[model samples]
Target: MKPINRRSNAPVFWGLFGAGGMLAALFGPVLVFITGIAVPLVLILPADAMSWPRMQAFAQHWAGKGLLFVVVALFMWHAMHRILHSLHDLGVHAGTALKFACYGLALLVTMTAAWILVAVGF
Candidate 1:
């Protein structure tokens, strides 16, 4: 039997999906609590926990920009990966085109987020 050709790029997308899933799991609940529960009730976190000026300051900070960029872009990657696979499962076998669309959209979002963050200026 000839040696199998096992090389593939699935690892790259899988890596992004894993990382994004982890980040989303870690932060998703906190965000929901803050925006969905705490903020609405104004009982746990302070009323101004996410007020405009405070959020503006946070977004303008370099560290905060980095965090936002990572979270947004990674989540986009995760979503795209999921969508691409789901399309395949649904009988859409457009291979290279599908991969390009999904990953390209993710790349576009990532670059846009980075540019906006940088432009916002601290």
Candidate 2:
């Protein structure tokens, strides 16, 4: 008897969520520290560590663009998945429409970020 390949795509979504959660946990605080404290307080980075021109250049760079894309996309997937699962955990009625809406919003944000980054020019 031939067995059917009935695997689901849940792993992919879970992987994205894991990556995003890790990134958010690791980088979120570091980013905030650098931008909010270090730059302003002259601790590690310079005052203009996040200046406009520098930020524009970062967005224009290939590595920066990819980093931005991955972070944004993963974060969207993580947030959407969390929300969907949390609703279920909280005993809320999570229907297909809710799934579509949450995932759809994540996709929308990711696409918008990508478009804006591309429009920012390379």
Per-residue accuracy of model 2 over 24-102 as CA lDDT, tens digit each: 8977798788877898899978778889999999999999999888888888899999999999999986687997898
Q: What are the lDDT figures for the candidates, one per model?
A: 0.90, 0.88
- Candidate with top lDDT is 1
TM-score winner among the candidates? Answer: 1
- The window of 10 residues in a row where model 1 has the poorest summed lDDT is 89-98
TM-score of each: 0.86, 0.83
Q: Note each model's CA RMSD in angstroms.
A: 2.3, 3.7
Candidate 1 clash pair list: none
Quality of model 1 by C-alpha lDDT? 0.90
lDDT of 2 at 12: 77
List model 1 lDDT by residue over 32-100, tens digit each: 888899987997789998898988899998888989998999999999998998888899975788889
